[model samples]
Target: MPASAPEAPAPALPRPLIGWRLLALFYDLWPALALWMLASLCFTLGYTIAGHHDPHENIAPLSVLQWALWATCWLLAGLYAVISWRRGGQTLGMRPWRLRVVGADGRPPSWQALCARYAVGTLSLLAAGLGFWWAWIDRDRLAWHDRASGTRMVRNPKP
Candidate 1:
């Protein structure tokens, strides 16, 4: 009998649509919100337990407490996204939409890339979703985070 030829590798999946990414974001927000609420409770409880706070003191624009809370939320959310991406490429939200974030080399992203993605993603959201909209005009359909972090979201084919 003749030897069988080697099997061909499967082709890569297509890039996900902006609308699918947006839907995944909406799903992801629920968990992020829960994490934020927990952080808020801890901050409030600690502030109250410390006691002797000035009742008449007004919050400055650059309040330390506010910044701390914001940092807490940022760190938690970053950990969630980065770890998920590194472990399996799909987050809890992305799984439902069959989305996977892959680096420029078409493999899992490095820690630095994931961090950049999270930071740039924040900027993208704060910019009134201009980053997401940018895909409509981008030749490769990449968003701000995808471009900035050298990562792209691709659709996962069904088994």
Candidate 2:
């Protein structure tokens, strides 16, 4: 009799582990801080170019511009996060950490899901970051944003 063909192996399931999440967090934090620094520099330069005798003198305009820049940065970050998450389940941060975000059914998240993720992420930071910390205690290791969006961050199966 001819030799029987080998059976195919079962596919691996996604795992949302702590180490990967922490690594992703670390990767994300530096870029966010860099953006903040850049925004501050731009604000200072704008104040100087406006010919204010003292940069501090034009407090109102500076405040408004500063807020605008900050909001813009946040929007950019959210867009980046959503696009990356949906396309390959990994952001620049998550890629380095070998982490990926996927919906509950192991599919790419929808646009609405992405919005939920970003909204929760923003609120998490605003509220002393408890939402980010939720992953640490949650049984499934999902952050608050992941929970709200019906998504999960898991170790990427492919290289």
For model 2, how does the per-residue alpha-carbon lDDT over 1-159 read when each residue is reduced to its tens digit? 999999997675666576676678678877767766776777777778877547665446557776887787787677777887777778778876678777888788898998899899889878887887877888877788888989877676665
Q: Per-residue lDDT for 1-159 in model 1, tens only?
A: 999999998887798889999999999998888989899778776776677354444334477998999899989988888998899998899999999999988888998998899899999999999999999889999999999999989998887
Quote the lDDT for 85 in model 2: 78
Model 2 pairs in collision: none
What C-alpha root-mean-square deviation, in Å, does candidate 1 show against the real structure? 2.5
TM values, all candidates: 0.88, 0.73
Give me the runs in candidate 1 sitting further than 4 Å from their true place.
1-9, 53-62
Those runs of model 2 whose alpha carbons end farther than 4 Å from true positions after fitting are 1-12, 34-62
